[model samples]
Target: MAQAYDPYTNVIHTMTKAMEIGHIDQSMFEILKNPQRETKVYLPIEMDDGSVRVFEGYRVQHSNIRGPFKGGIRYHQTCDLNEVKALATWMTLKCAVADIPYGGAKGGIQVDPGTLSERELRRLTRRYTFAIAPIIGADTDIPAPDVNTNPQTMAWVLDTYSQLKGHPCPGVVTGKPVELGGSRGRNSATGRGVVISAKLLLALEGKTLEGTTVAIQGMGNVGANAARIFYHRKAKVIAISDVSGGLYCEEGLDIDAISLYLNQGGKLLKDYGAPGVTHITNEEVLTCKCDVLVPAALENQITEANAGKLQCGCIVEAANGPTTEGADDVLEKRGITLIPDIFANSGGVIVSYFEWVQNIQELTWERDQVNEMLEKLMSKSFQELLNVTEECHCNFRMAAYIVALRKLVFAEKMKGIFP
Candidate 1:
């Protein structure tokens, strides 16, 4: 049997390795290793069936030294406090690496949204929001959407918080609908950022986006949009998958058609029949022959069990902690260029920062402006991470951790301990 996965342990492992490699101060390591605050709440919601179900939720503020705590709120059955803690810590590192003026925080409710109707989901979200409202705010901590949540979910959060304050407080949340003050490019920012990172990494090897074979695991917002963007960029999206299964074609799958099918609420790739499209299992999609493999599905998708089987030339983590430490060792031994999640999939938060700015300033920028700003931030950070990797003789993941940890620790030292 495979070893039990602990997301928080993976995070601390990476942090300790990066600190040792960077030769940072031990005291700083002690301070930067844990979240500043973690709150758990019980929300009792009245379901449409007239039954009362109490749900467990959490909000972890990893750090706020740079600015307000910034991260997304995920709703999934598997969302536990440890996972939230790890994600919150990653948010902090992601912001620092992206050079965004925000700290790191994460919130989640332990419930399978698929099991709840739209009405129940909304009620649960609202109740959970009210429960954690005291700790979250525009200038204190801002929550966006993550995993199973979307713009609509964010709207619910914004509305719930606003209702409590008895005023229109749009800044209380980001990733909301456009009419509600969401940034123009916020929807596809994470996917766009994934493609941007891939392009940057390829350019370093005298390559271009065109003619590259890519396989993305996960068909949600991040994975689907990433597949579409890469398809538009002339890359051969050989394989793609959802929770059900995957589809593959050596010559490249019709990304446009596949996207349309998925957008229509299609579930499994087995039902997505198209000419030349071959049915492939999720495992096959992960280990498929491709130039780039994007695991955007969930944490621990790529583990020691199959890490050595990954055939892609490069692995860009679109999901949080998709690859385990042991798996990372295998990839390093295999010389597969792996881009860390903190930097690779930060486009969403980067744009979320823009949305927060717009909400605070009560001003909205054009899509072109948002997209342009996003590219600059992602590309610049990519280059810096590349430099750190080369300078420290470490993998991209370690390099990113070193960069983020250094910034966070420096801030921690300057801030010092309160009396």
Candidate 2:
């Protein structure tokens, strides 16, 4: 029988492989594998019907050796401690790969946010914030928006934290509304970063986005933004999907129209109708023939079962842990170049860092400036990955992991244990 997928185990396996391939010191491996702290809080909120419901929430601080813990808060029904731990670990690697001065932490509430009213959700957010307040702050740890969470969620978190601290504390969170000290270009940073990664990868193959065909799985913030950017760059966004399912068009999807439809609150691609658009299952989106297949949805979307069947020449993982370790082996054997999520989706954190800087220094940057700096940093990081790839003679995923693990291990070595 096949074993159930555990994202935490998958990450550890990948890290081990990277360390082995790069000949990194193994003394700190065990330390890197375990989080420094894990907090699980039970949030009891009064629903709209006046019934109290207890929801489980988690906050896993993976590491803070390099700097403060930084990650996102995702509201997902399947969210659990192990999942949060995996995400937090990924954030540590991501920040290291991006060369940012931040560690990794992740928090999530196990609840389907769609079933909650706005008031109920806000109350839940406040309760969770109050529970984790002691460990999180502008200088200690910061949280942002992740799956099923958005700018409004971050705003609520910021408000709750500020009220608790008895002052306005905008830097306590990132991905908040621009009015609340959130950096410009943060909302779409991840998707933009995905596009930039695709462009860079394509450039290596002597191609460009002008006529490239792309299929993106997931139509959330990351995927939707990438679809729009790819469309504007003259790429044929042939397929896209959400939780509702996927839509395909051989002649290229009308991303602008699709985005508009999805933006009008409570929309799903399955109900969408357009000329030459055909509804397909999410699996089809993964195996669709395209130059670039971006699994921007969630973890384990591309596993060994489907990895061998993928038709794309390359994959740019915009979602953290979207591809499993077993699938990675298949893809590598098939010569499918995959740009790891750690570096590809670092845009959000990069801009989050910018937002944090602006909030701490009482300054604001123009949107263009933020975006230009994001591209510059990603480009530079990509070069670093290439260098590591050449040095280790490994695939991009291994190369990225090597780059991150080396930095993390070095930080641990320098910051040795203290009493």
Candidate 3:
């Protein structure tokens, strides 16, 4: 039987492999293997019906050796300390690979946000924020939105943290509403980055996005935005899915219309209907015919069971740890180029860095400026990855991990042990 998938273990395995390939120093390997701290909080929130419930939440600070701990907070039913640890580690690597001045951290609650009413969610958010406020700050750890969380959630966190401090603390969190000091182009930054990664990869083969076929799993913020951006760039988004299900079109999908429907309210692609669009199971979407398959949803979506069945020419991970280490080997054997999530989805955190800079500097940049800067940073990082790939004679994923591990280990060496 195949081993049960543990994201934390998977990350450690990858790091070990990268270290072996890069011949990195083993002294800091132990330090990098584990998180610096892990905080678990039990939040008691009163529902609109006057009943109280306790939800488990966690914040894993993987490292702050590079800079402040920066990552996202997600509300997921299966969230736990291990997942947060793995995500935190990924954030550390992501910032390093992006060459951004930030460390790695992640927060999550063990409740399905959809099951709660708006008021209940707000209470939960405030309570969770209060539980974690002591550790998170602009110069310390900054939190942003992740799965099942958005700008509104960050707003609540900002308000609660501010209330506790008795002052406006806009820098305490990223991905807030623009009026509250959030940066422009932050929402679509990750998706745009995914497309940019794809474009970069395609260019390596002398191809373009003008007619590339793409399939994206997860119609949430990252996936939806990526779909729209891919459509706008003239790529045929033939398949897209969410938790409910998936929708497919042989020619192409009307991502704008579908995005409109989803944004209207609580919408699911399974219930969405349009001409020339066929509803398919999420599994089918994964194995569907496409030039690029973007797993933008949660982790472990693409595993060994289906890695060999994937029909896409490339996989650009838009979600954190979407591909397991086992699946990575399979794809490597299959000669399927898989871009690791740390680098591909670094757009969100990169822009989060921009937002934090804007907040600290008390300045605002136009959307165009923010986007141009994002592209420039991603392009530069892509070149770095390419150079590392060539130097190490390894795949993109390993090259990225090597680049990140080098930066992190060097920083830790410079800092030395704190006594």
Candidate 4:
């Protein structure tokens, strides 16, 4: 049997390795292991079918030394406190890696959104917002969208929070509709960042994103947007998947048609069919022969059990905690480069910082402006991570942790213990 995946443990394993490799941080070791705060709430919403349901929800703030608590609210059936804690920790590290003025936080409710009707979903989101309202704010803790939550969900959050505050508090949420002060390029920021990470890593070997055979393992906001962007950039997306299953094509699939089909109600790739396209299991998608393999799905997709089976030149994580610690060793031994999640998927939070800045100042930026700023920041951070990787003689994941831990520990040390 496969080992159970615990995101918190996974993060700690990487941090411990980084601490040993970096070899200068023992004072704050205990401080780095635990979250600063973990808030849980019971949300009761009236269902459309005349029933009331209560969902368990959580918001974990991992750190706030750098700035306010910043992260997304993910709604998945498997969402729990531990998962949120791990994601919150990554948010802290991700912001430090991106050099953003924000700490780490993540909120989520344990419920399958697909089973909720539109009205029920809206009520549940609003109630959850009300439940967590006391702990979240524009300058204290800003909530954004994540898996199963999107601009619409953020809109509800913003509206609910604003209603409570008795004013338009756009800064309280990051991924709301653009008309309501959302960032212009926030929708594709994470996906674009994944592609950017792949491009950056490939460039080290004198290669470009064009003509790269890519296989992505999720088709949600991040994976679908990534596939679209990669396709537009002339990358051959040989395989892609959603929660249902995966699809593959050796000569490169017609991304445009597949996207349109999925967007038009063919929600799962298991039902998506076309000429020359072959249906494959999600496992096949992960281990497919490709230049780049993107595990954009949920956590623990790549574990020691299948780590040696990955056939890609490199792996770019679009999701949080996609690769396990044991898998890290396996991939390293196999000579496959894996871009750490903290650095690879930091784009969402980076642009989210931009959105928060704009909302606070009542200003907006053009798409090109946001996109350019995002690329510059992610690339600069990537360069720094690469430098640390070389200097420490460590893998990308550990190097990223060392870089982030240095910043976090230094801040904590300077701030000193609070009374």
lDDT (0 to 1) per candidate: 0.92, 0.96, 0.94, 0.92
Superposition error at 268 for model 1 (Å): 3.2
**Segments of candidate 3 deviating more than 4 angstroms:** none
Candidate 4 Cα deviation (angstroms), residue 265 = 2.9
Candidate 1 clash pair list? none
Candidate 3, residues 1-419: lDDT per residue as tens digits? 87789999999999999999998998999999999999999999988888889999999999999899999999999999999999999999999999999999999999988899998999999999999989999899999999999999999999999999999999999999999999999999999999999999999999999999999999889999999999999999999999999999999999999988998898889899999999999999999989999999999999989999999999999999999888899999999998889999999999999999999999999999999999999999999999988998999999999999999999999999888
Q: Which candidate is the best by lDDT?
A: 2
Q: For candidate 2, what is the lDDT?
A: 0.96
Native RMSD of candidate 1 (Å):
1.0
| TM-scores of the candidates in the order shown | 0.98, 0.99, 0.99, 0.99
Worst 10 residues of 2 by lDDT: 410-419
C-alpha lDDT (0 to 100) for residue 289 of candidate 4: 97
What is the Cα-based TM-score of model 1? 0.98
Query: 221-281 in candidate 1: lDDT tens per residue?
Result: 9999999999999999999998888999999989888877777763567788988888889
What digit string (tens of lDDT, one per residue) describes model 2 on residues 138-234?
9999999999999999999999999999999999999999998888899999999999999999999799999899999999999999999999999
Q: Cα lDDT for residue 340, model 1? A: 88
Model 2 residue 186 lDDT score: 99
